[model samples]
Target chain A: MRIIVPIKQVPETTNVKMDPVTGTMVREGVEAIINPLDLYAIEAAAQLKEKFGSKIVTISMGPAKAEEALREAIAMGCDEAILLTDKAFAGADTWATSYTLAQAIRRIGEFDLILCGERATDGDTGQVGPGIAAWLDLPFATYVSKIESIQDGEIIVERMVENGYEMLSMPMPCLLTVVKEINYPRLPSLKGKIAAKQKQVAYWGTAEIGAQPNNIGLKGSPTRVVKIATPQVARFGKIVQPKDEHELNRALDELIDMLKQKAIL
Target chain B: MEYKGVWILGEQDEGRIKLVTLELLKRGRALADKRNVPLTAILLGEKIDAESLKKLGHYGADQVIVVEHPVLRYYLPEPYLNVCKVLIEKHHPEIMIASATTTGRSLMPALAVKCATGLTADCTELDIEEETGNLIQTRPAIGGNILATIKTPVHRPQMATVRPHSNKPLEPDPQRQAQIIYEKVDENLLGSRVKRIGFKANPAETASIQEADVVVAGGKGFKKAENFKMVHQLANLLNGAVGASRDAVDLGWAPYAAQVGLSGKTVSPKFYLAIGISGSVQHLAGIKTAEMIAAINNDPEAQIFQVTDFGIVADLFEVAPLLIEKLRNHLPDKEA
Candidate 1:
């Protein structure tokens, strides 16, 4: 069996800052890490590899620096790594990103399963996973909480539902977008880190993947960030400070009256 | 044109339809009505048991497309997507609406790609342009610090997935009726990918924080996981659910399921009790839709107070017990 995990490099949420003037995320000095959710996908892939004698390949589509994310996935026990980086890929939305990824996956050839995080934190779109599955014309599942069993060309798993969970099984060559509840990700070992440092990561650009220029980047993206601006903060009411019991009672009464006036009580 | 209507993907689990599907139908029907087009609902399930297709008409559907297949009893992305894709290709609708549930979230993106169109996910608001008949999709951006309105002007079938509970489901009209279109299942496709092995429903008693009417949410101010028990107790007493700020979840004081923020579940319960949470834009985005919001914190200047309908300037540790005690005494037994 072969498992492919698609990972993403995202600006660390804690260090992420917005440029007030430009209304864009300040990324110049922010540290980039493998998207936290993608770690689960990598882990799930590694577990499958361990159990089924499968190979785990980590793929990422981002800037050149995104090689670091692939390296980290290698350190986490991925057998191979591929980085899809090119100037043309910049500013791509989920659709473009998924298209590029689908081409990359096709280039990688045979894979029994494709795994992805439910959504990337930066985009919070959760579209790429299913989008890839769609492009590949494969069966896919999202918000997968647990994998019960996989054998004989079929994969069985638990899908998280609003009220409860349901068991689902799909044939091989399926895509799965996992949630955090699936499994706890493992830390990189010393041996794994050393091996990752020595491993060469493959790089693929749009031309290498045979993708048309019109469908591989910002120009291909149908949706655009027409405008980005901070939402206006609503004005809050004045704070009432009460000095004595009488004043406290009056403030409480006034508050209730206001609630009544608004018909919120 | 083979297809002359708008279609809604109705999501159902455990014999009950999801609320968001109804909400989407309500909005879809309105869109169809505005365009002077038929509103159709696509119901895919196995042994659906009930005559729920009529409910679609009650909520304003001109037709209900029913696909009953045992293979679809449980959601296997392959078969479900295949069925829908075939249906869509055969009958191309002008617009498609789906709930942003786990299934819909999984299916719509893939379906959109198959159709070679664009999709806006987790949209808070959606409307059709009166002149151009394009979808105006509105959603939060930059961790909810910004709101973006997107449009897919060139797409053939405009598609948008809306968050659950964001919009109200229309009231059912028993007198309404619609044509029920039945589609035969392709046995070969159904037998292809995905097989149903077993099903385990989550214990309902576990209580999903997303459904809580009153959420006792804690934040970094809680200091430790042990302190979260107070929140749990209060939630238990109130028959609500426990929630946590992203800070608390990141601090490992709570599980991700209990988190309320941009990355977590967006909840709009009737009453939200935020304990010691200093509201960030992301956190506020998840809870701003609540009907009533109350905040308790030691810091009087906390941002939570700004959006809260009621603010209590007191230490959560102290105020929480007092509020719980007061509610126990003042409220009815069921509420308590």
Candidate 2:
């Protein structure tokens, strides 16, 4: 069996900063980590590879620096890595993003399964995985919590839903977007790190993947960010101190009355 | 104005139509009415459930498109997207909308890519442009620290995914009527690699948060796992639901299903009480749409206060019991 995992590099939640002038994230100088959720996808892929004697290929579409994330995936036991990077890919939204990724996957040829995190930490849209599945015209399951079993032609997994979980079985060559509950990612070992350092990362651009110029970048993206600004903060409530038990009860009653007046009771 | 109609992506689960589908139909009808265009719904499944299709007319769909096949029973991205693509390609609707449920969220982005159009996810508000009749999508951005208004100025069909329950579904008129168009499923395009074996549902106790009306949410300030019971107790007293900040859930104080954040469930209810939460950007992204918010924390500068209608700068451990007692005394005998 052959498995492909898509990973992303995101700004550490704590260190993320917004530029006041552009209303965009300040990516420079910020620490980039393999999106925490994608680690679960990598782990799931690794587990499958270990069980089935499969080859694992990790892919990422981002700036050249994103190669670091692919390296991290390799260090976690992936067999190979690919990076889809180009100046033309800048400012692409999820739609354009999934299109580019689909083109890249087509170039990579055939695969038995594609795995990804439920959503990216930066965008939090959880669209790309399904978007890829849609473009490639494959079956997909999202918010997968556990893998029940895998047979020659079909795979069974548990999908997390609102009321409960549903176990779903889909055939090979399906795409899965996983949540954190799937498995804990393993830390890189010394031998794995050495292999990752020596491995060369494959690179692909828009021309190589046959994506239309208008469909691969900012020009291709339909949605535009008009303006970004800080949300206005509402005033804080004034604390009311009670002098005695009678005053305390009265204060509490007044607060409740106020809430009722607001129709929030 | 090449595009000129509204489309709703109808989602089905286990032979039943999802509530979000009805909600999207209601909203789609209003948009179509405002623009003086037809409101069409597209339903893809294994079999055409007549009972569910009939409800679409009541919910305000002017036209219903059904694509039924045995392979379409479970959500396969290939077949479902093919149906949507075929519908959009044939009719060229001006706008498309979908509910921001798990399935919709997963499918819409991919569909948008296939259509080569833009898609705004988790939008809290959707409106039509008076001049162009294009959809104006309003959604939280920068981790809920800012609300961004997005527009696809040059696109033929403006698309968006709305969070569930953000807007109430209109009352079923029963008087409304619509046309039903059945489309053939393309079996050749369907991938042979994937097949559904069986489904096992998750336990009920852990899954209740999705249907919760009044959710009592706690954050890192709750101190320890034992303190989470205060939130549970308050929820039980009010016959409500329990939620937790990403921090609390990450610390194992609550189940992952109870996590409320950008990466978790986007819930909007009549009443939401946040306890001991400082309100990180991700956490706020999830519940900022709640109609009424009450926050309790010892920190006077907590960010949760920004959107909260009422706030108390007191310890949650101290305030929770008192609040429960007061609610028990004042609330009506039956649950609202």
State the lDDT of candidate 2 residue by residue for B1-336, as single tens digits.
Answer: 467789998888767887788889878987888899899998878776787788789899989988888777877556666777777888899899988877678778878877878899888778888996668888876566577788898876888999887876779888887788888756675553455555655454345565566788988888988878878777766567888888888899987888887766778876788998887656766787777777888787676776677777776766777776787788757332
N/CA/C clash count, model 2: 11
Worst 10 residues of 2 chain B by lDDT: B201-210
lDDT tens digits, residues A1-265, model 2? 8889988998765334444344345557868899888999999999988898889988899999999999999999999999999999998888788888888888888899999999877777788888888788777798999988888778888888777676777877889999988887899989889999999999989888999897877887899877665554343344543445465466557667865775656
lDDT of 1 by residue, A1-265 (tens): 8899999998766335444345445557767889888999999988888888889989999888899999999999999999999999998878889999999999899999999998887677899999998888887778888988888888888877665666778778899989887888999989889979999999889888988898878787766655555554342534444455455455445544554464433
lDDT of 2 at A156: 88
RMSD (Cα, Å) of model 1: 3.6
User: Fraction of true inter-chain Cα contacts (below 8 Å) kept per model?
Assistant: 0.46, 0.55
TM-score of 2: 0.87
Question: Which pairs of residues have clashing backbones in candidate 1?
Answer: A169-B194, A169-B195, A170-B194, A171-B194
DockQ of 2: 0.43
- What does candidate 1's lDDT look like per residue over B1-336, in tens digits? 444578889877655665666788888977898788988888888766457766777878888888888777666677787898888888899888898777778888888887777788888777778997877888776566567787776765777788776667789888888888888966776754655556655454335766555677889888888987878777766567788998898788876777887667778776677888988766876786677777777788777776777776766666666656644553446343
Among incorrect, acceptable, medium and high, the docking class of model 1 is acceptable
